[model samples]
Target chain A: MKLPRRRPASPKKTAVGGSPEATRAALLQAATAVFVASGYEQARVRDIAERAGANVAAINYHFGSKEALYLEVLRRQASERIERYPLPDPAQSATPEAALQAALTMLLSRLLADDQRGFVPKLLMRELLAPSAALPAMVQDVIAPQFRQLSAVVTALLGPRADAATIQRCTFSLVSQCMFYLFARPLVQTLAPQTYDDGAVARLSAHIAQFSLGALRAQRELLERADA
Target chain B: MKLPRRRPASPKKTAVGGSPEATRAALLQAATAVFVASGYEQARVRDIAERAGANVAAINYHFGSKEALYLEVLRRQASERIERYPLPDPAQSATPEAALQAALTMLLSRLLADDQRGFVPKLLMRELLAPSAALPAMVQDVIAPQFRQLSAVVTALLGPRADAATIQRCTFSLVSQCMFYLFARPLVQTLAPQTYDDGAVARLSAHIAQFSLGALRAQRELLERADA
Candidate 1:
């Protein structure tokens, strides 16, 4: 059952060399597909190995177990998102508003942009709904850092003295605006097919930035008024 | 494997009498669970019927097939949400601002409220991700109408003269905030475990309402300034 298939390991021939590195890369790609499709309990290790045109022993040798292989897919996916759409360094923008806008733009790109691991959102979303052991790593390694980054920009935009809860809520609000595009893709595709297009993403970025900044400024004024 | 169990349908005995209505209800309950867990493709009629303490023929007798049963769950789930948390009647609010806030409140409540059928979000979420046959009914019967209603509130808040795109974007922004509380529940739970609690829901509700309204009002003022 673990025999390598004569056919290519997918269209890209990710396992071209059949070397350990190539086999590991091939396994990650195949494991991601299988995991996203069948989830944790149902996904079979043999299927993943077959998809990668490698032996099951390779999965054990390289990743130790199926859980470790799944974790690698997630970790790689998280890093790739940052690499592909790095948040505009907070300092790069000339003003607080620009910084926020830049962040939103990059975020929209990261969420909307599809790469090799396009299934990451669905994979993570499943875990979110029905948490497994992975929920902690996802929160700590990926989500926590991203939320903090957004919170910092939001705090700067709202003024340094913004209360913690308010900053957190604001951060959640801003991230959700971008996240909805990816998270609710199926429903959006069914109802409004045009939203995922690049043009739409760009437009959405502008609207969210302006709308968020607009709201923050308004909230600031209201707070100041109450203070006065 | 599809044999009818002789048990009394323990617990509520949703199918106690084996009456058509009771059987149907029982099937819906059990189907909701299986479908939410395994999705459309993976869910089996035998599992659902057994869970509901009925037989396979009862599924055929009551809902026609697994697909029909799944569709009924979505339709009922959709209607139940509207019934449980109907959008605030438009006339009750003296102003558009109040109308939008009320609507946001309703949406958050609908999203966050867990009842006898707390699995609705997860069920709908899986469909939204993979989207088998039920996507159309979900969009048409549930999601679209709600969006139009929110768009109307956004239009009123932005003033009747606001263009279509701005209103649409604003509506998406507002809905995403609430949906995030539901959509990103896993991540939210991991980081801000307080969000789902009653106190957090109320506070978050207030924050989203004000944040959205504040942004709209600020945008209104900016538009006016530009016009002047």
Candidate 2:
């Protein structure tokens, strides 16, 4: 049987070499892999260009610098996947739990599905540990907006009294719950040598959603308890 | 005040210029910085040695290969920190929440205290994002045993009814809660701009402890709810 075609690439960039834009897109695809493998500081433009099947000068021509290219790769990876897997339709259901779970499911599914998408988390983790000079810009342009949106969604579900600090903490907790699998894979596999396959990913996704729901529910309960 | 005297050269590797062991230690230290800055694939033995104030031959003479040196750096960092910060004494607490909170506090304190100790999370994150040839050894020797020990502690606290999967999920949640601050500092700072200092770290520590306790407590409640 033919495998399902992967999700369509985000409208932002299409196939490489199809046009001038495609060549830039191709350079980004190649750069993501190289940066994920070697990291931004060590990833060479020559290798990225070669991987993209473009001239060495193509990277500079398209992105101006290796740093610029790396930032672009981060943006493309984060923004495109998020857009492709749009947040759950809020109109579907009224409960906060339902909306929260749908949003989380979308996020987790994207994280676990695409192989090329693996580089995004890896790249972000690297920058987090040892931020490059470009990190501020990347965070401001790409990461901050996504997080702000997530916090807003979570806060709305949580209601007005949730407070900015509580909302921020909850957002961190939700993202961290999802990210543990990707960021701590080696350790997880080592700790429970039995559980690293597709089966495990399914279980993990379910558990994360359940765990998050429980936490969110508890927060709501606590608020009710306090008011009572 | 005079800076606390650097730990006198340990007998394990005196600072004598010509000793093979000293050369090996120096190379590892240098490699840690290089790897932290440039990451594994892009870090060079020459640059590492230069950072260590040693000759390039020092790496080849002691470690035999760059990959070996990288692995050794990770090993040394993990082992040294583990040795320095002994696990919390289990006898200090009776409740599972108390025991786990104690452990979490110790782990997070070490992870965020200062640059020297903080490097463990940074280095581990880099490897997680981009596994190199050396990653398996690094994980086995450094990450696994600690996680296994922590998992056991968590299992005991959660009780026998908690299956391996439940315990593992909880462990991942607990760790992610602890490590998230260090791993997501830039993003946190960018989004929350005003709250990224010691005050935030204090809030994070308290929040993680509470969050983790709530999750673990919920596990027990879930088991109770199922039985009822």
Candidate 3:
């Protein structure tokens, strides 16, 4: 269902001067905070506008609608993080194993970095847990490419002998080990307090990398033996 | 913080007659539906009582408060599922490999069961995502024992040479693989439909078991080499 087309009855003056770019940027920033604090369903355009210091009509003027604004917020945050923490070129590492470690470390750095970009993980996780109209598009446009990249790395690590299904499961196992920290932060903090401490990102990435490398190498050996 | 003390000013006649056990059972049944539907914060005592056909006073008399009632619901559902799907005795399996697979199957069965007992997983997941007052106790009383059981199986597989931290990480890796299906069902359904279909529990159990076994065996070999 489309959100009601809410054109403010009377458009108010721009709070951040008459710069459309500034207004749009401010709206996106405010929208991120509002969306993160209260998920998609509960987030109010009025709140987003007020926080942005832009009029409600400014949201419609800049992003067309709240859903569109939300999509932009999600898309921008994802791209920004990927740009900041892009996967290492396979050639950069000594071996596929090192490449895998680099890839996992990069992914974990994105997922676990406790910094200003923190809102992105929280926002994405909210979308995952209680999905909104934006989920399908977000998965296809944003998540699928990242998933495919990781799959390619897994395929390389598993070698040509591994079946397609096996490659996919291995890819998921690697990703899940990383994503679980995002999905179950509270549980992890409660159960393994040390694992969730300041060194969590490094410690978890190393552990997942080693653990997954073992699984991948073993599976490769098994497939090789079967072929022989 | 304690829930405010609320005693119905006028205790009405019991809906399912004067039998305390009958009223209590009805209240529990109704409360599960309400809690599962609305979650802990939004669920109303009046609605639970009305659905049970009992008076509000019955809730107070039986459960003491809404928080207590919610805890009882969580506690009972957990115990019931565990009773219904207890982990296999380690002695029954020929090896730790078999035991690990058996344990994974048991866990996936409980997590993925598509039957009347569905409310428990949904309820438990809700608690995990948006924790309430009952979470710490639930983790301790319900989840920790199961975690310890899985830890034992993992330790048996990893061997005595591995350090405590390595064992803990490996245990979490195994669990995170199984739980990814639950926590990210929508993503799984969207990304790989086959993995979440009718045969999901079996397929997932097999994949996680094989993958985790490979990792465990590899770690064991690595540990052995280190000792040598």
lDDT of 1 by residue, B1-228 (tens): 454433444344345444567777778889888887777778899999888878889888888877888888778877877777777777789988788777877777777777745566777777766667777777787678778889888887887557777787888899899899888887777667777776656788789889998999877777667767
Stronger candidate by lDDT (1 vs 2):
1
TM-score order, best first, reads: 1, 3, 2
Expressed as tens digits, the lDDT of each residue in A53-136 for candidate 3 is: 788998998888888998898888877877888767877888888888888888888888977547777777767766778778
Best by DockQ: 1
Instruction: Show pairs that collide, candidate 3.
Output: none
Evaluated on CA atoms against the true complex, candidate 3 attains a DockQ of 0.45
Docking class of 3: acceptable
Q: CAPRI verdict on model 1?
A: medium
DockQ of each: 0.60, 0.46, 0.45
Question: TM-score of chain B, candidate 3?
Answer: 0.74
TM-score of each: 0.84, 0.77, 0.80
* lDDT (tens digit, per residue) of candidate 2 on A1-228: 543323343333233444667678788878888887776667888888878767788888888888778777777776776566665565575766666666666666655665674665666666677677757866775456556666767787666667778888888888877766666767666666675666655677678767766666667667777777
Ten contiguous residues with the weakest lDDT in model 2 chain B? B5-14
lDDT of each: 0.78, 0.70, 0.81
Which one is best on lDDT?
3
Candidate 1 backbone collisions, by pair: none
**Model 1: per-residue lDDT, tens digit, A1-228?**
355644444334335344568888888889988887777667999999888878889999999998889888878777776676655678777988888888788777766766664656666677676677877876776567677778888888777557888888889999999989888877767656777776866788999999999899977877667767
The digit string of per-residue lDDT tens for model 2 on B136-206 reads: 77777665655665687788766667887788788888788777776777777777777556655566767
Q: lDDT, candidate 3, residue A90?
A: 74
